[model samples]
Target: MQQRRDKDWDLSIGPDTVRLFILKAKAISAGVNEDYEDGAEHEVEFDGDARDNHHHDGLAEEETEDLTARELRELIGDLNVDEAAELVALAWVGRGDYDASEWQDAVAEARQRGNRRTAKYLLGMPMLGDWLEEGLEVLGA
Candidate 1:
């Protein structure tokens, strides 16, 4: 019998980002898990996004669009909790779409999911990180 993969994992993202990430994770999980208990737990201001309307009704739809990896990184700038979590989910399937840029956010996000250590190390190229870092700034991520 195969062992079932556990979904929740522990991770770090600089102390400054940890709390923000936790809130984002909560909001995304709440949105994705329809049966999620305590509906009030995930509520936030939900306004101030340009993609959304004055009432914030369009925020959900705006997040549904796929962005390039480079776009994704720059997009994460000052993202609220829900947006950040959603972006991390997108990164898992974001290969080929990502420019060399987006290294830091990619690595930080991958670490957040606890999957990067094994997966990233196994890629066999030591310079992937360097390329990602340099390219992220160059690509304007």
Candidate 2:
């Protein structure tokens, strides 16, 4: 199979926002090199139970404020891999400030063009999930 682009490994994001599922597969799955290891798979995360958790460390702040409750929900309604990845990328674009109108417009346009996927596919390699799953809250479906 072809390897994901360098952007997928380390996006130097600028005016354009692009992400491919192939990269997610690479980052979430096995790594390159002879001593490659499935770190995420075997890494023991013993933070604590949800009740006692005060982990704000993993979450990024909002970026696109324009993504209103309805808009964001609509975007994530039937998300696919691409959409999920884009959401993750967008979160970065928003710089953890996910409350911008431009971001909302971009997402909406991408959706119109048939982008958006389940968040499961865009977990690591930059696109944070704690950030993505929260969008589901907007949908409340």
Candidate 3:
């Protein structure tokens, strides 16, 4: 892959937008994991075991689609196709799936993957915030 030589990485999306996304991702991550703070138990029901005791992994439905999730979704929903693709690429970079050296490749891959469910896809990642931040740092943005 050809190296991106300049300090100005040609991201279709702005760094401020990426930073905002980072903030929301961080909030969502924190909110989802918040319930487990004091050993708060969440109940999970299993099939064919109505009588059996339920175990909680703190991934309750409410937690999954909480205010943070909604806000994150809204934020993602507002992004255009190009921006969404860039966001995905950044997340992948942060996750160690791709290095900054392969930034263009990562972005191309993200573009090919489609951006229809970016919010859901990103929200599903447990470390979305950290990954995006890492990607930003790698890009020197």
Candidate 4:
């Protein structure tokens, strides 16, 4: 991804930070819908009757998802009011609720909505990562 030039846009939060959030969001998305045994080969044994044995190794995956989610939540929670609102506005643009030309209006609306539940609201979106990435692209970040 190309770095956003300071002269080109005035962003409350850094693009790099947004990229990190995208990565974590994608990880959480994958972890939530993933099946542990999708492509693994299992050995079957015949002792009187055929038996299929495969261990469901979802515990580790669950833990990783939990950690990633926590990190994402923390990251969003730590942002300042302006930064958090910017994130919401970016998402709105990415989701097609607003066009890139309406960025200021979207940001104003996001700020009006407040950042009290920003993390929770953002985390609830299953397509958070994709939307954020699309938003960044739209903004030429």
Please, what is the whole-model Cα lDDT of each candidate in the order they appear? 0.36, 0.36, 0.79, 0.84
Q: Model 1, residue 72: what's the lDDT?
A: 29
Candidate 1 segments whose C-alpha is farther than 4 A from its true place: 1-13, 35-141
lDDT of predicted model 3:
0.79
TM-scores, each model vs. reference = 0.22, 0.24, 0.74, 0.82
What is the per-residue lDDT of model 2 for residues 14-117, given as tens digits with 9 covering 90 to 100? 21222222223333333221123544532345555635334442223222222232333443455564444456545443344443324545455544554434
Misplaced by over 4 Å in model 2 are 1-98, 116-121, 124-127, 133-141
Better of 1 and 2 by TM-score: 2
lDDT of 3 by residue, 76-132 (tens): 889888899899998998788887778889888988888888888998898988888
lDDT, model 3, position 130: 89
Best by TM-score: 4
lDDT of model 2, residue 88: 52
True-structure RMSD for candidate 3 = 6.8
Candidate 4 residue-wise lDDT at 15: 94
Candidate 2 residue 46 C-alpha distance from true site, Å? 27
* Model 1: per-residue Cα lDDT at residue 32: 44
Which residues of candidate 4, in runs, are more than 4 Å off?
1-8, 36-52
Per-residue lDDT of 36-122 in model 1, one digit per residue for the tens? 366653355446563433354445543642122223233354455443443343232232233333334554664465432332232
Superposed Cα deviation of residue 115, candidate 1 (Å): 7.7
